[model samples]
Target: MRLVRGALRAWRDSFDCGGRSVAMWFPGHMAKGLRQMKGKLQKVDCLVEVHDARIPFSGRNPVFQEALGVRPHLLLLNKMDLADLKEKSRILEQLKQEGLKNVIFTDCEREENIKEVVPLITELVSSNQRYQRAENVEYCIMVIGVPNVGKSSLINALRRLHLKKGKASQVGGEPGITKAVLTKIQVSERPVMYLIDTPGVLSPRIGSVETGLKLALCGTIRDYLVGEDVMADYLLYNLNKHQLFKYVERYGLDAPCDDIESVLKRVALKLGKTRKVKVLTGTGDVNVIAPDYNAAGYEFVRTFRKGELGKVMLD
Candidate 1:
């Protein structure tokens, strides 16, 4: 309640570029009074839907489609840094199939990557709103995304990249950063578009075991939802039949088979000596076991990310 109010006040006090309207969009789980904010999106001329490149489907806002109801949207795939290049390509194709024509993959931390989307965003807004000299378009552009997926980072990068600093005030998130803000950036390229950056959202579906791990890796879910051993077990199970099982074989483990549990136990045993103890250590000295479970867990993630398990998308 308080965060939302504070954000609304900040936007109201900010200077207006034209007859434009902007507002922050956030997850339903983040705060109270959001239920009343529903149907408010109907007023926006264009929607800027932000999603993670890694798990696009899981990172999407469940209420977005319902709220917008045929409104035009520009889907921004943020955080290209952590995404698998192959998976990122596939996800973009999938989104096009899902009816999003305006899409841009960006790592807003770098200005070069950020500028590539300027022409695309400009074209989308111009086409959707169609501002003419005779009459003003009076635009409203809303930015929506899952929490901690770099929504604020994108907005901040936008201001800095465009050299419109000292003009916008963005709120900071609790236990995170940047709770909410809706600001206008004077884009000489895209004069008709009024930008609205909303608070990040963490949909409830992301609480699932696999999706949660993905979000945790993305820094969206901060708490230790899964321990090192549990995560390693998950990776082992998921990657048992993975396409790049050859990598495991390269490490001298047996070729992975259909039975995932067997593969994990084998991995545990194989790394036992590295951890300075036996997999089933009792009386044996602790200096001769495989890699510790925690270390093994990191290796699993590292290998998985490096395509050791093959082309996999945790969608």
Candidate 2:
């Protein structure tokens, strides 16, 4: 997509999260998942952390580094299809500077770049010290990541590639799809490899509201928790900031817009997302048809998530 350059109008420099606390967004189930993963750390040979490629620089749970970072790790940035990869090399370089040398971009749904996963895992484990597992020939890997980043999809993709098998884990579009640490599912046959799938967990204390919003935008967190209205606004802000104007054409707008309510109103009117509501007048009550802004906001956010508005780099 060719973005228009030159004198663009002003956009939001920052977003107001309405004083919503990060603690409210962190659910109890995620805490339990983290504890369960820690207990099974000793049995695993390598940690494959899957994350959304769009927000590569932010929204990662620090607990993964503090608790599970000791093992040989590979950071797999999933959902490559929805991310802007023009800056992929730069992103990798920044991650390398932070001591993360092993990284791969993958689209689990299409199973793109999945052929390289097994070999990469083998190389990482072989180069690192195996310790007590030196006598064991089979390899066991633990898949970890923030919520809804496609942990289960990656496992299923590997299984389809190596074992010629069907899904061993459940896949969904929302966060917290895998509720617990599941039993190991074999993905490769020749070298005898198995992967343990864990529920997506987030940090109990997120650093900032923007990080939380980014995670929410990527479906790492529940949409209602951050509010659909605010998320739609933030999405618009990022789209304009990056000069991604596909939304203007998609929603049938005459020009680019910064006001989320105005955009959503247009979307609601065009899509016929309206509801009849009773409003009291000075004389009597009358039913009036009004645009469902919530529904419109949801569709706007959904379109962006599906990459209909064009690829975005939220970091």
Candidate 3:
């Protein structure tokens, strides 16, 4: 009942604010979601799948393909500013091999990039419609991606183009900010165009069901949780598989003969460990006086961002 009321209120508010009639279909299950929108899917004609340029594979919602089955989709890779340039080109090539021709690299924050989007979308929509403007034909395009990839910001920018009301919320954070179901924004003087902004989806790793669900919801193991010593252990274990040891040298961390415990002890010394070995190991309820745990954590993540841990995709 609450969801229904919220949807109605949103619809009414959007309608009053120069928006054409719009309805949102909340399809929680991928299969059911696709089926519910099948009728509207025929009218959609064109679809736009937005993904974070950093982790394109990770940012994608698998259900998008199911919903947009057999329909034309424009893959907009946004947030290039935060991504590794080398990976972008590699992923783009991979997607091309998958038979996706309509892919555009964009940083939607820029005016030039925003300008390019509408035209590209317009052209795609026109092509899908065979250059014919059918009566009462409503053009619909859905924007989907992982959390904190700037979908709201993109919608807000698009709203600026149309000069509409009902502002899209400005989400500020590292990632995973937007939580609403779907937001429908409309253009004033068009064929009643509709833009659907769905909730951001976190990607799941290939693992046990519980682990996958946790990754998909909270995210894939935040570095801050395990502290630097433990984080370094995980990174070393993973990167050593590919013979990447520059990470330790980069952070000035001692690479003590590939012994995880030995390296942890070295890290503790660098961090000004005041606690005794018994305390550190919790042998006698001794307080582990690691004063620089936070600093160590930052350094570890910094090294990772610098690619010292090799080409690791934390999806």
Order the candidate numbers by TM-score, best to worst. 2, 1, 3
lDDT of 3 by residue, 23-116 (tens): 2222244233344445455556666766656455553556667645576678877665545466656787888897777787776566336656
State which candidate, 2 or 3, has the greater TM-score.
Answer: 2
True-vs-predicted CA distance for residue 287, candidate 3, Å: 6.1
**Residue-level error in angstroms, candidate 1, position 162:** 2.1
Query: lDDT of each prediction vs. the true structure?
Result: 0.55, 0.89, 0.53
Q: Report clash pairs, candidate 3.
A: none
Best by the lDDT measure: 2
TM-score of each: 0.60, 0.93, 0.58
lDDT of 2 by residue, 113-170 (tens): 9999999998888888655445448999999999999999999999998888999999
How many clashing pairs does model 3 include? Answer: 0
lDDT of 1 by residue, 1-315 (tens): 346322332112221223322122233445432332344554566667777666676646666676554666777777666565676667777778988766777776665377755556555656654443233454566667666666666666776766566435353322135454444444333344456666655554443455655554444555344455545555554444234455457546645444434555565566662445444467654444343445555566556554455554456
Candidate 2 ranges with C-alpha deviation above 4 Å: 1-8, 18-20, 130-136
Q: How far is candidate 3 from the true structure (C-alpha RMSD, Å)?
A: 16.2
Point out the worst 10-residue segment of candidate 1 by lDDT: 8-17
